[model samples]
Target: MNMTSYEEMFDEYVKSSAAYCASLFEATEYFFKANAALEATIVSTNTAKTSTIHSIQEYFETCKISLIKTIDLLRTFQEIHTTIPGEQVEVDFAQQYFYIKKTLSCVEQIIQLFSTVRDDKNLQQQIWDNDDFTTYFTTSADSISQAIIWQCNFAKRANLDESI
Candidate 1:
């Protein structure tokens, strides 16, 4: 490819990849915000009982936003990878892709689980009924962070310039 063409491809890849990273960060922030809202509701007094349901509602909103962001990022990642082609598909790139795939799977499952209980009269109650909710949520969140870290490490090692 000509130098300008290569530079254009590089710029496209970098922009898309950076967008994916930004979406990931936004999702992570929403996840934490949801967690904090839930926790705050748990510690509130009887007078603030309404806050319980409100907090749960907030959590749902944030979770939905995060899920949407993740889906968008995943699609963008795929397009960037496919369009870039050739040399960009290095070993580290493949590894990072796998990590992202795993993270996407986990996020999908979380969204599915939440969807089933989303319309329940008492979301907090449904969540409380699930003994594994905390463990599942914490583990999934940690896995996502690990996957993002793995992707960053791969990019750095490969000198891909998409690190962020």
Candidate 2:
């Protein structure tokens, strides 16, 4: 496939990923509201809260997997085009830089929200007290961080400003 086709695929992935991140943020907000309501009603049970945490964790895992796949696709594109002429590659890199910036913004928002959720006293206790949950959450966060780092490195290699 040509660079244009790769660009199209990258665009679609970014759009989808951004939409997914937005939905996850919204869901987290809703979860907070629901938890508050349950607490106000004196009906907030540990089981219900734990279930919600699990649901959010699952969502995080799905997002992480999607990001990793997207990064792999980007790596494949880079490897295949490694021998392309400089001028053409630079043009393609310039376009990809914007897409990467947009993706970084979405990922950063999700990361911040995830940190908030993870740091909540109740959620922290539940996650930390469970060995499996602790490992899962940690692994998910690490994987996502690595994916972000890979993208940043790619931008740097292309001589794009890190500020993006």
Candidate 3:
């Protein structure tokens, strides 16, 4: 394959991964909000909150699916890059590696938050209202955004095609 084709593939991978990451982040935020609302409802009402729980679960599932898709896209790009002749590819592998690691770290933070929410149903209020949790969430979101921006910039530079 030609250099242009590889560059095009890389551009697509970066854009697709960024989109998935954005989706994952948004879903997680919604999940937290839904769970917080459910907790408040539970505290105020004596009736079952099955529907609220189900809705929160759906948001959680979306996050998981988006994370998986993003990871798969990164891995596929890496695999393809490695298989291609070195002379035909101009991507900076080191930058790609670090970007992947940084993005994965952000994803791991979300997974940890998910586990915390899943394991302890009683601490929803504390988790949702805590300043530390807010900071943590914001930091993770910022990191993901920075990583995506860096990746897009790198892809543009590598491709030499400003259209991306």
TM-score of each: 0.63, 0.38, 0.47
Backbone clashes, each candidate? 0, 0, 0
RMSD of 1: 5.0
Q: lDDT by residue for model 1 over 1-115, one digit each (tens)?
A: 7889978987887887788777666766766666666666555534444344445546546655655665577577767777775765443445545544554555455555655
Error of 1 at 39 (Å): 1.4
lDDT winner, 1 or 2: 1
Question: What residue pairs are clashing in model 2?
Answer: none
lDDT of 2 by residue, 34-104 (tens): 33442332333444433453454355445544554454455455544553433422324444434433443
* Reference-based lDDT, residue 41, model 2: 28
Top model by lDDT, which number? Answer: 1
Give the worst 10-residue stretch by lDDT in candidate 3. 45-54
Off by over 4 Å in 3: 1-57, 86-128, 161-164
The TM-score, computed over Cα atoms with residue i paired to residue i, of candidate 3 is 0.47
CA lDDT of every candidate: 0.62, 0.46, 0.54
Q: For candidate 1, give the lDDT of residue 5.
A: 94
C-alpha RMSD values across all candidates:
5.0, 10.3, 6.8
Candidate 3 per-residue C-alpha lDDT over 81-133 given as tens digits, one digit per residue, 9 for 90 to 100: 55555444355545544644554455455445545454334555656665655
Please identify model 2 stretches exceeding 4 Å from their true place. Answer: 1-58, 87-125, 160-164
